[model samples]
Target chain A: MKDPLILVIEDEESIRGMLRMALEIAGFECIEADNIQSGHTMIANKRPDLVLLDWMLPGGNGIELLRRLKREDSTKELPVIMLTAKTTEDNMVQGLEVGADDYVTKPFAPRELIARIKALLRRSPGVLQDERMQVGKLILDGESKRIFLGQEILEMGPTEFNLLHFFISHPERAFTRGQLLDRVWGANVYVEERTVDVHIRRLRMALQSASLDYSSIIETVRGTGYRFSSRSVVPAAERFEASGMHSAHWQ
Target chain B: MKDPLILVIEDEESIRGMLRMALEIAGFECIEADNIQSGHTMIANKRPDLVLLDWMLPGGNGIELLRRLKREDSTKELPVIMLTAKTTEDNMVQGLEVGADDYVTKPFAPRELIARIKALLRRSPGVLQDERMQVGKLILDGESKRIFLGQEILEMGPTEFNLLHFFISHPERAFTRGQLLDRVWGANVYVEERTVDVHIRRLRMALQSASLDYSSIIETVRGTGYRFSSRSVVPAAERFEASGMHSAHWQ
Candidate 1:
């Protein structure tokens, strides 16, 4: 709810300046990136609360940059609004599929773009928590945006981090992939259920790399999807023993 | 930007009173319905900008009314936040699955509920444009929230109105079921893609009932889902001739 700083990733100097002027007039602090590479670097260096990415950068297009950001653990959760041209609506859809949070077509009213920026920022993933969370050996420092297993840091994609953060927050309960998609990814997205599987796998992998056998905390419920339990995480043989008489049953 | 009137459909009088006080304190006008039957009526008559529904009611639960509202094109777009008790989390999932926009666990802080209400209203479907739109004989009056074909009014569920509204606004372009779900239902909802097919069928049926052959504008684009073309209303055989070969291809 604080005054948000916005990063403008537009290749065109005129568009970037235009956006900065508009955003500043609306009382938002703004930064600029003229190409995809700089945009990505700026995102890492500046840590802007939200990003306004232009779809057609010279060295790499906006979709490429968007995909990279979404793929990375560090920047995946950043709210990104792509600036697109009216004729390139297909590219806009592609950008959305690759995880651009929202988009504004070029030749759009500046008012409309600012409105979208405000809306996207209002419920951005950043607003959810700023606390340290722990489940057994795993510790998620929401304030610093880092995860640790015992002593080692568990590095993962932004989505993976978010998935782990959610699991740590709500342990001992099964979440269907749909529910995970709704909660961890935020309800506004239209991501595929398969994406949840990919992120879960990456999260477990991150945990495993940090500490062997640590990944067993994340359990797969046959018909129900995934769940995280902080109890005895010994792989398969002790699984039945770990899940005592009060067992989870799926219909 | 106007002061939002929120309807709290909670059965417990104590909780209801608590909510009214909290909402009123937050500058929201409040109304209440103690059960599902009256809840539905209040929604129809009162037209609150947002709804806070408690999952359990005496005769029929809140899911029943949520389903009924989502099924009707008239109330489907209404923003509903289910007031779920923490113990009945599964019921909360069911409420969300049935199309309640968001949910808050009961014994929730008044501040959290007010925040959810504010966030939901910030991007409610009601905040979109209010202008009458025309596509062929079909006239979509965004101001009155009605659809008309020739002289007769075409009544639709709120979702259908939104779908038709979207289609009329973005005509001649095919949209996948996922895209339709995101655009029409609002990006925040996690509705199944199959729901799009059901709504499209209903919208077409409503158009057909008002007039004999007016349903042809809502055409299925084979593998691509659907599109609204105001050019030709003729079904099937004339379809090939009507699509005189700036043809669409699906991979």
Candidate 2:
């Protein structure tokens, strides 16, 4: 297989050369850009597998470049790892909030840099060559952008499908509305959190058509946000086995 | 720095010896246990930085071992990685479901194993060395498992504390009920899925005592699950944002 491509956007010639050499040694094809303009141009033309973005650039700053990449439909899904000198918590939050997949501080070890790249690549959806995702009776085909519940295809809007896609891929963590917005909506756009509610409702309705137990599957966290659980709604038989028939485990 | 202590629980003598040598080379102090009973005792006494558990054992399975570790208060925080020959889909889900922080299929390279060990340690609360988790005014002490809103301490149960701990540790990204159960409850217990709902309610009540805006913090996904967010619940924000926003941007 051909080596995965990496786009490095940095102004410093020395740093750029160093990163190119390191990535090349690690079996990645390198595309270097001296500034944000060239970076965007390369991004538009080359569409590299991943982008190693510098936080600061001459005209459009890295944050601005990140915003534009996330805004556009074609590039929104591209994985980005920010390379920055700013290691403060606030800057980290802003970088993450802006949709950078992961970040590394300047003066990082080459080994650490390579490890992060490999980890990010492994986690990216593009790395999974499988065109379909299947769990239990549910199936999601990335190629067709279709979902199948058992044998029957389930029809859902783009938003609901994307929501389901995220949930299925990373199951078992409660996500707040803000997080959903940041991930699903992209970091650049500002939107109402409640809109998450409308889309969630639509997604559930779509799942219901397959006769699945959508209610118990997507559990409400009351004051928290939402979680998708494959746990049975009924307390498992084991609970009864553990708690003697006399004392009530439920208060 | 003193080497981080690691407990290796496996039946095979050769594998155990190999792991012991490799871990020592990787700057970790090692403790060995052949059976589940002995492993539990070693865990109680040593309180190792991490547990490398073999999935198949002569006396008991690794899933059960993980369950017992997570149930107890003292050892519950310990990170575990399962080493196994079984690479089936069901096994992966089951291992993860049973609270194995990570799993490595057998015949694995030592480097990959060590990398995973280091990665888990880095993410672990104790190992991360970050004492507090704070989102806005809400603060959680990882070492003490205490919640403080401003200056006042918030009262909570072990389960609620764990729930809050997981939520704060991973902000954003909605988790479903099954995932929460596997994570917070550990994989072995068969409690009512709705029990998560009850605990969430109790947690909210505790947060309310501090007069913190806990209500808006945990958002209900209606049919999906729960998420903890810092976003405001104002309806006007939703109307204004949703009108022009793309459906994908809900979080």
Candidate 3:
């Protein structure tokens, strides 16, 4: 997918230029708004996917504009990151409380800012939101946020759910740990790559709990990460038929 | 840790009573304030870890109180999740724009509220805040938000940093995927258990990036999840000495 368009609302030409250069380098489309008046108009007219707002702009307090944007339904769900020179907890908390998804202090690293922007864009609704997708009997219902294996509900955490959902959506493609982390955990969020292994184990365990052997559909590429395979596997149910030994117990 | 105290600010007696029962059942201590005046005073005096705020109140709007709270440093960072009967997108947006952490509609499930509370509590800055901890040459400097391998800086994502930090904090103890999620990812956030593994791999990769042979510190428990070993291992630096090959390429 092409990078989402980012609206930059800042009074300072230098900072706005810096942001534009950084965002464009990250492959995102950018639109500039010099002050709150222009920012509001730009938002209403352009309807950018995400916004990078200045906390203090010429003519008005940047926060009031944020409140106005959030108070309206049309602009309410828009992901916004507040850029400010203020480092006080009062301002940071107020900005966040006022619905800013992220608050970055001025003179911030462009790399980190781009990373934060990407992360927020990914978290925005409808990006990862998808209707139910099925691989074998394992069903991921996105609307209700539930997973089902045939008649039984498969209990798993949100990370596992998203991971499974991502895998199932792109069935049969092998994803390395780095790609999975960026797609699943997000770029700004950090954790060990091995964490992927842990969540996968839990996913398989959930499948086991439902008394299903559909876990084999999520194949492990020997040297790399994992893949959700659409192809048929030697049915584990048939393989262990005589033992009647449940994989759930083993997990 | 003991369950954190939660203050429920609502005008309705029945809803407050329901909240009290649910919170008490979940082992959380509860306090209630029926009006904006009392709610403000209760927050100031009681200093609860989390607040369940009602949107509309008897004397004034509840969102005004939220704005006031967010506007102050003393009350700021005190997690507040809005409880509202109003299901309008405008109300939700305004409440959130005013800085309410999570907004829940009336007749909501108590279980979901508690989950959200736990998640928000875990996300609060101080809960996981700790001074730097060192395991060998690796240092997780909390204040600087940087990791150091000997004199070299280690680059990693926040999740990997936290996972490593958490592991280093409680070395040698095995923690299940559920425990890790609660402590590291926060409760409401979801992902697969195998995600833990993927993160671990990523963590090791980070260590490799620093040219460190410390990957052996994190060990996967046979039956459950993972553990960080504080004990000495036959240093791989010595084991593969003849090859003169760095582990970075292997990862």
Candidate 4:
């Protein structure tokens, strides 16, 4: 691929110079703007791969530019990494909530800035899109945050929904409680790994009440973890196919 | 270092016979429990290195037994593998989410069962433990999900927390986005590699807000990924001590 073009939007000439030097050395092509107005124009004209946006621009801030870019369909997916000195929880959360892919504090190391830019530019667009999945009679629409068994909708908590989504997406793989905690509970949540068991039970109970034998669907992998198996819940004939077994007879 | 003892808990006489024979042949000492109640007794009495539990038993299901074991501190860490006819998503998820170490479906190849058991037993206990680390003024306590610069706590999102944890644990090692996602995010997650950038920036922002200047702490390995450097974040006097670079000097 040609060198990824990075658009730097900062009012400080020195910071911009540092960024340009670091980016060039890191083999990235770059363009510059002193404020959002020029930044907007540069983006429209140049269509750079990513924007290294300053949190505080000359006129309006980077957040404003981020909002505008996200609002417009053509630029909605343009990746932006905010350069800011703000590191408060509220500020960082707000920046991310506004769809800044990432943010670097001012006085950032050249290598850190370049790494952030490379990472943002390398991201695929589908990462932001909600997906829909179907397995047998079950349907999960991630965008809608809804699940269906055939035509009937299943009521489940958001956490349960996420857990189910993960399991379905990664079928047949067994995961430990610790792994489940990291994956389903989010990596840094610090909840007891056993919490996974409670949620699993809740999910299973929900499925059970819906008249599905949940155990068959979520087979227990003794001593290891759990797996989403198509065969366990199906009739014996169907199970053979689900497990990739050609012969039905085990004896 | 005696051969690991494996407890086989299955109601089927033939299956139990097969497991005992297979386990013995695999050089494992075997114990048998025909139901959940008996399995509990055997575990309490024998303290087998691993349990091969069946999903269905004579009196109660294996999940109930699992819940009881995991609830108790002494037996909570005991590795368990579930043997079941159930292979559907719900069943597998329930079993896994409920804390079965791993599971194998009925008519499972003896080799497959042995392999799963071996894998589960091979997992180090450290994987399940919450560890704490100190890097200069930075204190990361995994159990509490807290990071501190001196006495002040730094607030960050779950992803950022995990990224920092991974970086600190394996300091100075450059990790590609793909590797970061695998080690920090669970292996099965299909997130965009660029998402690592978002988390890395978030971590840096958290560190920076606390006057940590983590750019030095989390170094960018250009054309690669990221690293945590003791020298960058610590004062010159402390850097020598932190990195063990006491004799080296830059001209």
Candidate 5:
């Protein structure tokens, strides 16, 4: 798959530079614009996967652009994260009511920004494409909240399905039990990381019943966290080709 | 300085274990309490620098403990970060209204937790003592929003003052431009991370006029970000002694 493209629209050259560097390093293609005129043109032309928009911009107000984007069907569904210095609750509500998918205040940790971007991207149409995703003969029907192996349905809890869905959608990456809780269980839900281990066991058992061996697929990095691999497991040789999965071992 | 002690008030062993591992690795002392009864006792006896609280407990609700802590003069100023599975707006409002220093949703990245922990610790009474902080000859008065070298006030912009205040409160720490923006600028603002450099430069210039060569204090961490050091910087030994700052590189 091609790298996801993100549009960074801000008035500050230094901030734009920082975003460009950070986004590219995080494996996303970035296009920059310093003002609303260019921002609108870029959105209309490049059609980015997501936008990192500044609340205060030159030539136009960010909230106004957000309103326009939401008003027009062509851009309405585009995922956006408003970058603003405003920290008040009223400001956040206004931004959300105007249809921002997320909010990252000024001076945000690049990792936080990247996390929010990744989360928003996961929900974007380009990534979701459809409600169903297939890997090998295994199928995940998100719309129906069901997993299928060939024609047979796999019985699992909603949490297991959500966990599997997240893994499949974001394969070849390690997720800390914490990240799993945030991504699969929703950020605010206070489930234990061991709860992740329990669910992983259940998921593997369910997949095993369907003649799939998860012991190799959901590889656990000792003392670090868990990861989802698309490649065959059990042998050290196959692991070399799946190097990307190890990149996030710090998780 | 001794490592800050953090009390983990949570019931889940797995989550508590994760917090312990993460906290100890980050150079902080941690004490775990599974219930509010023990939690209150720990607070009274141990008097930790901060608290990583779980919203739900076996015997008492986390919010109840928060209210009780805030109401009492002894613990009222204690900084608490509520770990919750509750992400609803009303829930957050309630948590904040009850006086949680911050909030970290469940399934948080270890780095995110550490960041909030560090930020809250910086605000805790033991650290702040007063609205003022002293480092060498520099005096940062939070209430007045002013910095003084001995007796004279240093001239700077609001952003520069905020940046300096954060650096003073969190000395011997290296923070990336993104982290600086998040910490100093307020996370939601869409300012460029490089804007940090501009304010930093301005701050340095202002400090230099007071005969303080900030080039040594605000050391650049080649390919990483920036750090504010208390020790003299020309030698490699001081850098090793100042290593505590790197614990937050993951942020």
Candidate 6:
């Protein structure tokens, strides 16, 4: 396969050089744009496989660029990661909410940045390998960002699909909202924790319409967190007579 | 260590005998209760490590038994798994919504039954060897069924406590509603999927009183499921500029 094309969008020459060098070393073909206009131009012309966007830029903001990318029919599905100097929680949330695929804070370890980049690329539908994930009757097609419950298609937003994809890939384990943001919303974002609840509500509502049995799939762990399990446990004493099973005795 | 005590509640003598024998082989001490009333009495007195409950009993239905157990302060913490012949999807939802820890269908293999029992026992707060699960400033005491946010005790219902406990124990993954019911609510229940949402709202409300950052801990994956994380990606992104650096590139 051809080397994955990576586009870097930033205003700092030094950082651009750094990213270009790192990405090239990591076996990706690198392209650089020094501002939003040039970035947009390059995106329109070059159509790189992935985009690395800096949150702050001259002429137009990084978020605006992201919105434009998402809004445009041609670029809506292109994966973009935000690079920002700000580490505040709200900014991270906003970036993710606006549809940035992932983000990285400034001064991050080169290895961590590379890993995030790779993960984002890997998660991009139909780009790399591992196209499908399943949990019980639920199936998520990463390539198409579609979900199937048995044979019927289940409709959901991008965020919900990503979240479900994450859960189906890893079952029987629980995750908190903060961790969810880190994994599903991406490592770099700033948003209110309550926002997770709103989205959860939305996701559930969508699933309910599909006639899929969503109850046994996502469990509330009470004051701790949430978990996914294939089967819920039966009370032991109740099990004996119902199943006509003999009880074990201990000395 | 002493063998874990398992209380078996069923009306059928032959089935009770089978469970007794099976549990003993699996290294558990068993106590038999032929009916719901007797089972409740034994639970109050014996405080067994786990309860194996039959859905249909002579005195009361298993659902009512679960409600009583969850309502009482002392027995509320006890983990209960339902045993039933019902294999329908609706039954599974109801069993979990009512607060059973897990469930096993009738005609289940002895090995499968034992495995489910062990998994539930391991997840029970006091029974398992792993006592505490910590993330950030939050601490979950599995033995006491308590949550401490930086030394302050956080009050929660049994369901919320279990949810939090599960999230802390298993981090960095997402869970769908169906999976949660199977793990947190147990199987063989017929409850509305909306019930999970109500419980989640209640759990969040309880956690809010403690000034704990519960919002960031549990995230909604929009169209898919819920997740728990230690960090809120959105909030963290706002602080990025403070790091004194920014990426420089365009696209």
lDDT (10s digit) by residue, model 4, range B72-93: 8898678888888966756664
Report the lDDT of model 4 for residue A126.
29
- What are the DockQ scores of the candidates, in order? 0.02, 0.02, 0.01, 0.01, 0.02, 0.03
TM-score to true structure, per model: 0.30, 0.31, 0.38, 0.31, 0.39, 0.31
Tell me, by TM-score, which candidate is best. Answer: 5
lDDT of 4 by residue, A1-251 (tens): 24468899988764675566456545467899998898999999998888898888778877898999999999988989988876677777899999999988755555566667656764643231155665556667766778777667888898888788767665655566656654555432335556778888777665553545554577555444666655455566655453453211111
lDDT of 3 by residue, A1-251 (tens): 23468999998754675576557544477999999999999999988989999998887989999999899999999999999887889999999999988989865666688778867776675443435555555667776889888788888899888788767655545566655665566532335567789888888777654366777777675444676654444344543541232111110
Error of 4 at B185 (Å): 29
Please give the range of 10 consecutive residues that has the lowest summed lDDT in model 5 chain A.
A242-251
lDDT of each: 0.72, 0.71, 0.73, 0.72, 0.73, 0.70
Off by over 4 Å in 2: A1-49, A52-130, A232-251, B1-251
How big is the positional error of residue A97 in model 5, measured in Å on the Cα after superposition? Answer: 11
Q: Which ten residues in a row are the worst by lDDT in model 4 chain A?
A: A242-251
Residue B75, candidate 2: how far off, in angstroms? 35
- lDDT tens digits, residues A110-135, model 6? 45787787787786654543466554
CAPRI accuracy category, model 4: incorrect
Provide the lDDT at B12 for model 2.
94
The structural similarity of chain B in model 2 to the true chain B, as TM-score, is 0.51
Report lDDT (Cα) of residue A1, candidate 4: 20
lDDT of 1: 0.72
The interface RMSD for candidate 4 is 21.7
TM-score of 4: 0.31
lDDT of 1 by residue, A1-251 (tens): 23588999887888888888999998898988888888888888988999998877799877888878877878866888888876554665466556676777887788888767765554454335567765545667654456667766666766787788788767789999999988887765788988888888888788875345578788899888999886646445445643453332111
Descending-lDDT candidate ranking: 3, 5, 1, 4, 2, 6
Q: What is the lDDT of candidate 6?
A: 0.70
- Give lDDT tens digits, candidate 5, residues B1-251: 35788999999999999999999998999999999999999999998988989998989789999989877888866778899986776666567656675788888899888866764453233223226666556667653345667656676776777777788768777898899988877656788777777887888778753555444667778787888876753246544533554411111
